[model samples]
Target chain A: MSELIKNFTRELPDWKPRVRPVNLDEATEAQLDALKVTPSNTKVSDYVLTLAHDVESLKIRSPLFNAIMYDKGGLKRSERELGAIGASVLNRCIYCNAVHMNRHAQLEKDTSVTDSILADGENAKLSSRDQAIFNFSLKLSSCPPKVGKEDLIGLEEAGLNIEEILDLILSTALFGWANRLMHILGDPVKLENNDS
Target chain B: MDALDTTTLRAAGLKGSLSAAAALQQRANILHLTQKAEAAVLRPKDFGAYNHELRHALAGRICNLNGDQITADQYSGNAGTYADLIDPGNDGGNYDLEQLVNFIDKVATRPSDVTEEDIKTLQKAGVQDPDIVRLSELNSFMAYQIRLIAGLRLFKEYES
Candidate 1:
């Protein structure tokens, strides 16, 4: 019998993260300060909060994520999400996959495109532009060297200027780190059963 | 890596201001920490390592990227090296940090595969919880940095 599921991202799980995150009360002053600057503010994501152990790194990492993913002006927010989702999928971080895939769906005008990419990026009916981004992202996430100049050239050919090219690179790079850590730090999910 | 402001670089060849590059330079703040973090892990007041080869199988494998040689070579000169630890396939030379490094590498590649047993192994190797977190962070950071440069290399190498 096929299992009935309501939502893939949100309804998926209330699973526990592998490592215990610092509770709001347990956070040091520096960690609290770092949390403040992040997009979620005191509502820190498990991934961001785990870095509270090394507040200095969190201070550095948080702003970098903001600039690359949220600061705006290079790639469209949706495009950045595309790169993020691609890397997350390849790295096998279900936590990141849930977060970024949902974001991709939200930012994109059509959820179907995001859904298609999620199913099978290689066969997804993405426009050449997104295809370029997806191909570059997949290559970078798996075997970085297999990627080369021609890859960026294809992006350029797809009409992305050099700046957009760089934006794609940065977003993809940030997620590389983000996915790697998130995988180790914990899984993401909202548990069912009234917080049981 | 002359540390050119991304704004200036964009102005030279690119037509428009790519805010992400400037944001990356001004806001990402990782470049600033890269040196210190690199030191804390690779050098650590111990031996020096320039490239990723590490003269140690564990660290080398942990650092393994697509273009193993090129990826290994990527960090040379910029990060500074006090130890001649670049010789490939050599045992960790003089450090006993291999166990933790290998464990962190395993976790980074396959987090779900990690179990309590892995943590126990690290503990048996005399690794503390704090050190484990640090090692895990370093592994993740390396993955991030390597991917960034690898992607950028395309920009630098591609004539277009």
Candidate 2:
């Protein structure tokens, strides 16, 4: 049975757009060019299609998004996912949260951390290291962004170098951009046959 | 454009920081892309309803609502005829954009509380689907940019 997923879960949910997605047949040349770079050129999801309404933003955003999350030598992919989850949770973006939570789990090869977060939310018990990363990101994602010197000091004490810290900020803020679009423009639902 | 001249770095006041120089250099590509994104949202070639000037005004408004006057003032220079909307208190009613301004502010500051009704309100106000997406991209980008500046400032404080 397909239903809107109200709470956070590791299970990925399909997204349903509230606005009309651009019809592929009628897409402008620019939109077609932008859509071609989506994760899979063979098939595009409703989310990408909906974003196609603003083709210019979609084109630039894709490369920027990938570089922040997948770039090497700063924060590990798993920790970046944690930053993404922090922003998603603050924004109540169910779809974004679920996607990052699953990725965090896969990268760490452990579900316990994600399980704790799903169960406890802001109070989720974590190692000192994870706690520092998550707390800093949570504050950074807040309205008006409450991050302070102590937060930076906390990260330093937790052993994140400047480069890693910068990457963390970028990933969390990236989701600040993402959750607004995903949560405001659509709903997250579990569908019986939808592949997206 | 010089890496130090990027909006994010300048707004965050990190252009001259000795400690941040190397880290900023390492992430130059992300900074460059971030600049490109600002252009894509604020000054698109095929802008449907929101033009360049109105887009700057709205961007300034979002920055003000988020408590970042520095970035807001930077946007104000290009805000032009719609500059009055940059003040969050104005409500955009002067230009028959009350609904649009309200929606932008809420999405910028309280996105989690936003519901489907919000989008419907914009639609009922005659906002087209593509324009709605455009408004969202603009608002969402502000959220990211504001936080990035805030985070970097904190980093600067630590380094100093």
Candidate 3:
């Protein structure tokens, strides 16, 4: 068995659940529906299968997650990934951080930003816009959510309009939700071959 | 229900501003799904040990810990027997939920610090795995909702 990955990396890690995931064969109709297990679409990640225990939330969360992260016309997709990465980093969700960091790198086609974040965390030197986005997300991810007017000022000054800021907020806050479930219920492990 | 009339937008008090309201409306689908997700977590069809009232209490507790009094009050009004747990100062000793409440509070306030031992502690205390997932969804959703409200309120304030 591979050891749990502790530090954040741009490489996507495999998530191993601590609790028993719902057995697909024995899953209730509700769980199956939430998992969306058509014969042709039977492949589901263990992380998602674990969430299927509470099938109701799982059903609704998927669309909401996609809309917040992938919906066009607001914050850029890569910047939204930055918001997710910021929250994941603060929560020490190695899996969430790794996934979004890779996405951010892919979208931006430059690894320097994620490289700096993986190496230096909140103090990573970034462009002013990236700094504002990262700082606000990190603050919002904390308990009691340490954001203030200056954080908003930082975004506005960094040239984010209200729509972009709202998207940033949604993306950041959404990961506050994701990090808890991902970090608390599982561990990020080395991507083993045969994990297909 | 209007998509804009979600518990999240209401808790944020996101009214009286045309642009803020418009910004939210532009993502109406997300807001609508968010409301649905709230119902699914807060009042699911097959909630096990954590019934609707208990879920509300837990949600209230998480909101309070996150310092969002408005959102906390929204959940606390329905907290009933679990009202006392909304305050961080009061542990769950009175309700035979000391262990469960501790797990909830720790996961809510210090999620990064939560170790596998925390989940093990809950299991040792007789929390079944399914209920554990239910508890986590409630806590996790409340974290998202609270931060959403906080962020909207910040934007509203900035607009004014």
- Candidate number achieving the greatest DockQ relative to the actual structure: 2
Q: What ranking emerges by DockQ with the best candidate at the front?
A: 2, 3, 1
Model 1 TM-score?
A: 0.73
Ten-residue region with minimum lDDT total, candidate 3 chain B: B13-22
**Best candidate, TM-score-wise?**
3
lDDT of 2 at A100: 99
lDDT of 1: 0.59
Q: Ten-residue segment with the worst summed lDDT in candidate 1 chain A? A: A1-10
The candidate, 1 or 2, that scores higher on TM-score is: 2
Model 3 off-target regions past 4 Å?
none
| Residue lDDT tens for model 2, A97-186 | 999999999999999889999998877888998999999889999988999999999999999999999999999999999999999999
* Candidate 2 stretches greater than 4 Å from native: A37-42, A194-196
lDDT of candidate 2 over B40-145, digit per residue (tens): 9999998999899999999999998889999998899999999999999998878999999999989988899999999999999999999999999999999999
Q: How well is candidate 2 docked (DockQ)?
A: 0.89
DockQ, per model, reads 0.36, 0.89, 0.87
Higher-DockQ candidate of 1 and 3: 3
Model 2 per-residue lDDT at A129: 87
Q: Write the per-residue lDDT of candidate 3 for residues B27-145, one digit (tens) a residue.
A: 98998998999999988989988878888888888887888778888888887887888888888888899999999999999898899999999999999998888899988988898
Each prediction's total of clashing residue pairs, residues at least 3 apart in sequence or on different chains, is: 4, 0, 0
